[model samples]
Target: MDQRTDRPLSPYRHFSRADWARLREDTPMTLTQEEVTRLRSQHDRLDMAEVEDIYLPLSRLLSMYVAATQRLYRAQQKFLGTGDAKMPYIIGVAGSVAVGKSTTARVLQALLARWPNVPRVDLVTTDGFLFPNAVLERENLMERKGFPESYDISALLRFLSDVKAGRRPVTAPIYSHLVYDVMPNHRVEVDRPDILIVEGLNVLQAGRPPRDGSAVPFVSDFFDFSVYIDADEPVLREWYVDRFLRLRGTAFSDPKSYFHRYAKLSDKEAIDTATSIWERINLVNLTDNILPTRQRAGLILKKGANHLVSDVALRRL
Candidate 1:
């Protein structure tokens, strides 16, 4: 078989599920049924079985990468004859909204934690770096919530840069979904982790030169590895609409939610609203910004209409 296309993709293209299974032989699954159930509660469509099948092997592979990074760092230090602190292996996960990137990050964190070699695993979402709702409103960009310009990009880049540079006691702003805004006073600290997963919609975007023609560092530049979750636009549209309808009865019902007003709409009205939002906001952002960066990732997870990852495309090693 042309192993490159025969198996699920990774940074190394020729890996198969069997190959992954072999890599996972000693890797552990730390998540209990109760934990997995609790994790899946937010997205009832995900089950433990899917996690074991899709994520377990991937986490194992990441564990290996994490180990390899540590070894490389130690070797570089020895060659330089100077000691330096170990930095985090930063992983970037990018995808369209409702495309399951959050779930992927959480699952990988849980599974990667099970590897004894990796002591600490931290997951941070770029949502916290999003501009405050008031700022977004003033900029007339509340509708472009997940677009690149909606974020405090320099702040996000600095956080990743610090982490990769072995900086300690780094703190990032926290976001509240209820308020749909960045919480000014609240922050999440990373003293220093063995592995860090940064999940967001546009984390893989390339940097553009400044007006002075000077280079600027982008978030993806700090990534040790990156994954792009992808699917047909029509399929994503349907998924987004379905998730919106589900949230309308739940999170959207809470008065504090920015989308609370949506919960009160009738079924037909809700679907129309969801479709319009997708067409106007999410789809436009995906095409113009998100999808264009897919080739920059180390791996690509391709999903089917059922929302299952049916294909994998790994970049050439």
Candidate 2:
């Protein structure tokens, strides 16, 4: 299995599920089955076994990384003669759409908060940073919603900067899936959390250089740690279609849903529409943007067809 295809000579240390599970020895499994069920997304399959085998160990490793980061910050403060103040450990989770990145972020948030040292964990999705429907339509980017160009990159960078600088109560715009737009006047407030998980498709992407030859930091620059969720291309397509079908029967059936038209589609028509959307929009974004950034992640969770993590790759120091 060529897991790390982006890097011919990968710096990551790969581990199978069994081997990764062993590393969690003596680490407390604080989450219950109920909590796992609650954290999982609709139409996604996540069980306690998977949580115990995969996320528990990941949470432990992240906690250690967070602790080490705090120490490093304090040492820097002392060296620079600055006052002591803790910065939130920011984690970026990136992956192809329908590859379970949202569930992964939610699971991590729930598990990490249970740890005594890191009680406050906040999760913010970059969906909120996407251009509004009106703006996208005006720019002729409605069909390219998930693409990097369709986001307000400057706004995202500013939000991340404020969060990294410990600007409390940093507000983020809220995105509405039902409305298929960035909701105006709705915001999610992030009070100084101990750990913040920023989940999105392009969080790991490198920033373009400026014409002035000055430095421009990508959002990944603010990350203390980053995770990339991986899966086969075919598997992602299948999952995307499946999720679309599920949503058609649920959210799309609602009269107010932006995708309500899909609710009236027959099974065959829905399948065709979903497959077309995936091939046209999602696939292009994945190939042109998301997949290229895989090598930039500190950790990779490779999932199998079953939608469960089968292996992990941790970047070596």
* Winner by TM-score: 2
- CA lDDT, candidate 1, residue 287: 96
Worst lDDT 10-window in candidate 2? 1-10
Question: What does candidate 1's lDDT look like per residue over 14-60, in tens digits?
Answer: 34434434445655667888777666536435666667666786887
List model 2 lDDT by residue over 58-124, tens digit each: 9889988988988899899999999956888999999999999999999999999999764799999
- TM-score attained by model 2: 0.95
- Candidate 1 is scored at a TM of 0.91
> What stretches of model 2 exceed 4 Å from their correct place?
1-8, 213-215
Full-model lDDT for every candidate: 0.82, 0.91
Q: Which stretches of candidate 1 lie over 4 Å from their true place?
A: 1-26, 211-216
What lDDT would candidate 2 get against the real structure? 0.91
